[model samples]
Target: MRLKYYIIAIMALALTACSDFLEPDSISTFDTNYVFSNVDDARKGVNAIYVQFGVDGFRSRLSNNMTGNTDIERQSGWTSSGDRYQIWDLNALSSNGDLRQFWNAAYTAIRDANIAIEGIEASAALNSSDVLISKTMYHLLGEAYTLRAYWYSMLTYHFGDVPNVRLAPKAGNDFFLGKEDRNVILSQVIEDMMSIEEKMLWAEELPYGIEQVNREFTLGLIARIALQRGGYYLTPALNMERTSDYQTYYQIAKEYTEKLINLKDRPLPEDFRQVFLNNAKFVTPVNDDILFEVPFAIGNGDVGWNIGVTVQGGATASHNYGSGNNYMAIPPSYYYSFDTLDTRRDVTCAYYIVNTDFQEEFVNGGISNISQGKWSRYYLDAGPGASSAKGTGINWPMLRYADVLLMHAEAENELNGPTAAALESMARVRRRAFDSALWDEKVDNYLASISTSKEDFFDAIVNERAWEFGGEMIRKYELIRWGIYSEKMAETVQTLKDMADSAFEGTGPYADLPDYIYWKRNESGRFTVLNPNRKIAAAPDDTWTRESWLLGLRNEVTIYQEWITKDWRNYIDQGPKPGVARYIFPIPEEAVTNSQGVLANDGYGF
Candidate 1:
């Protein structure tokens, strides 16, 4: 409850990713006059709002929280405990430490944004100096409002109806405000973003290599917010779904996503892996496909330390990334779910990697074998010896044009089944996943395979999203919105159990052993781990035999076999039933205690 509501946002304007501005936090009295005295001051004020995106508690934790509890990823290894464990394990209490960090961090960002909004508004009359200055101030103010909307949207999504503080808190003001309806808050956020859509510049209009909050990304935010607002959400107190909102938001989501699709030059990249590689390598010549990314710099603030080596694994014969904790991996079922011909299968999840001996080796001594290669730390110049290796300048893509296309397809399927435009939009994503010549044919065959019904098409969209965005921290939310999180999760575990029940014998990693590993480079230029146990007819040419360890356990239970025998739902905390309230987290105990009865765990009153 000791929320330090101050002018910290304004005081830290000079601490940008690149140090070009001045620091005034040392000054006893913050001269408000100089803070907004010119266009540069206004620009600094707005840039401060974006600083939250790189903070330890905000975007970094957000990515982990969103992805950790899903079907595709699990928290294991050295770094998987404490608050994050509470989130994935599901025994999170109102007193959970991370819940407090997330709540406090979000409100801190929101409070600073309110200050920026007020300052920008006060400087409107002073913009009579230059034409460019006037335009800049307006643009800056627009960003402030859009950002505030974004933070509030996040709060409402994670924790139901939170206090809607539109204005900055003043000394001696009543801070114990009551919770407001999440829908009402989202409505205001949408209106605020709409008000400034035209005033802001697009990513393309900005200087090359500069990542900023622009018009298209803001519109994407709008589409995302509207979709949530219109979709089913647990109500406060009862934790029941708002059944009536789905249709309304579906239309809103479709409108905004379609607008994005129609935008000039906002095309999906031909290669999916290339887009990620560009970000990891820090592509000098920036591409337009990445609508928005959180910028980071070594020695300054960065996300690579948290996401790169931590999320992905260490150096292997297949790739190099110095050292990494293989803390998270996809299940065997998810690995086998992908079509053998699909390019995304190998890139999204790699079960086996070639060792130093140029032989396929299980990752992490086979504890948690699979690894995500989306953001490889080795892609950065920082090596194991570099002190800054942990702080590589790899940015996180919050919104990409590929997501825009998929959203459009999902909304269209919901509204009017599979239309031609929707099919083409979805096919564009598949084209990147497969070879060019057969891409269209694969899309046609996939569409034809699904039943010609809206529900069936939505099912396709659900699976497509999993393949398209494996480790991007999006699937859990998608499952919740569709009201199938529990059902689909049960199926996921069942898939694993079925594989274990059959033992390792049929295909993939379970096939019968012949000793030597079999692998091939897919069209995507990534290594695909084929069946490692395959035996072929050869005359004195082949001499590779199974390792002693593998031969010893020929028909015995393996790590994967042991994994399926335990309770898969152990990922959910010990208690807390899989109810609507369980989908979102509980508000921190201190906040509720300090709210003076103003903030109750209405939806999640467990």
Candidate 2:
């Protein structure tokens, strides 16, 4: 019940990565007096949206929460028993100035979008420009709407529900703007995407980047939104009682996912690793597979912090800091998903790390092993001292062909519980983990080599996601969607902690061995123990409770945010009896005060 509702979407926002956006004017001060009269100015407005996305991304730039990354690392005092995995801290609700800046920037861009729309309309009315200019006006107007909707969607995902302020004034506090219903917000987003869908073109054929919102990306967003809304409305993951709206969402998800599956924009890369780079702006110009993603310029672009050192580093790794070290690592049992012959294992990660410097030598989750290859060294070259690092790659996929296929499998599995088609989708991802040659021999050529049942198809999907996406944080969404991540994560973490504890004391501290470690008092070495760095297993700790520890922090907004003050007990059933709340999230407390009249969702924390 103490779990905060704010959860950063790790798998969210797939456009250009680590970019920046700002204009001469600020969102806090808006002006309709100055309107858009030319295509150039209108183009600037659309570009402004991408910049806003960059700023928004900066808020989550550090990590698995707001900065969603797949490489798991331990935070401060993570191994200890006292609230080691502090979930609230990882959530998007941070007091950090960067977060505030990004939030302000998002609104600033939103304000600009509003200004653009108003300005273009007024300009057209006054007959400001010629025929070409008039056509430009309409195009820019539609573009503004698309950008506005996209920004709102991003905000909604991170904060859950927010005030629907469509207009930004030239002056004064727009916080006075009343909150819009979540349903209204979603409806607006859908309308905007659909409107732009007709106006936008495929990036491949498009001449301009700003006006070039890919139709497929918009559709993907539509699909994602439907799923989220559906899950929120119906799934027991949040323990919601409502099921009335489930079927609608299920249908929407099914329809959109199917649409993406058939897209000819691009096919899956022959090399799975190539898929990412190929989509990057620097690599292939634009792979058809990527629907849309935040674009990061090279050199000056925001190369994310050295995630390997930050996420995989241990107690002594200099790159990792007090709060953002790696406690999370790959569970060996999970490794079975990757066939030993799979070349991706080595390419995705370096099984070993050589941190001679004691400071950064062992901070990588204390496991001493790392999955280093998942991210290219280009990202690492960008950061030296600072905890924040954004890589130079302009290419970040927000939506892609592979994800579409997976979604189809997931929606299908969720609706039907599981199916062969879903299993095939899952297998295709896994088979690619091996080298193309090995894959051809073992999987493609041999039909029966990889076969699974309905019940285990999801598990296979999870494995494929983990192995393929690895450090990208895509797996986290899968865990949440399935509603069992907390328990599984707790089990995994406790097992590692126990093994390390036993190894540390039994031997005189881990002997700095890689792989597996065991303690032994050598005959010639007196009482000194021989400690190998092999991964060890410990009995599950009953005390490690997922109910309390599983992802305490999230980018999701708490319904509690709506209430001025609340009786804590109303949200949870936990005391000695530990009763759970019917519905946990309250509208953001700010919304309750900001709305025209006080409004609260039913059964929220009550």
Best by lDDT: 1
Residues 319-360, model 1: lDDT tens digits: 344333334567656766777678887667754443333333
Error of 1 at 471 (Å): 0.5
TM value for model 1 = 0.83
Top model by TM-score, which number? 1
Model 2 C-alpha lDDT per residue in residues 1-606, reported as the tens digit of each score: 110101223112211222112112343322333335456655554455556544533423422333221223222222222321222223222333444444455566676676667766676432544765655556566656766776665555444455676764444544444445555687776666656554444455444432245556666677666655555421223343323565576667667776655554355666766655443324434445555555554432332333333333334445532112222334332333355676555445433332323122222332333433444322333323333234333344456656666666766776775566655655565566665567656555443333444456566555555665555544544443344444444444444443344434444332222233223223542122122223334214432111101111111465111111111222223211123222212333333433446444433222
Tell me the number of clashing residue pairs for each predicted model.
Answer: 6, 79
- Error (Å) of candidate 2 at residue 301 is 4.7
lDDT of 2 at 466: 62
Off by over 4 Å in 2: 1-35, 56-99, 116-154, 168-175, 178-184, 208-212, 233-243, 276-281, 298-301, 306-337, 350-372, 376-395, 415-428, 436-455, 494-606
lDDT of each: 0.62, 0.44
Tell me the spans in candidate 1 whose CA falls farther than 4 Å from its real position.
1-28, 31-34, 76-81, 125-131, 208-210, 236-240, 284-287, 300-322, 352-361, 365-367, 382-389, 504-575, 578-581, 602-605
List of clashing residue pairs for candidate 1: 89-572, 89-573, 90-573, 237-602, 237-603, 515-546
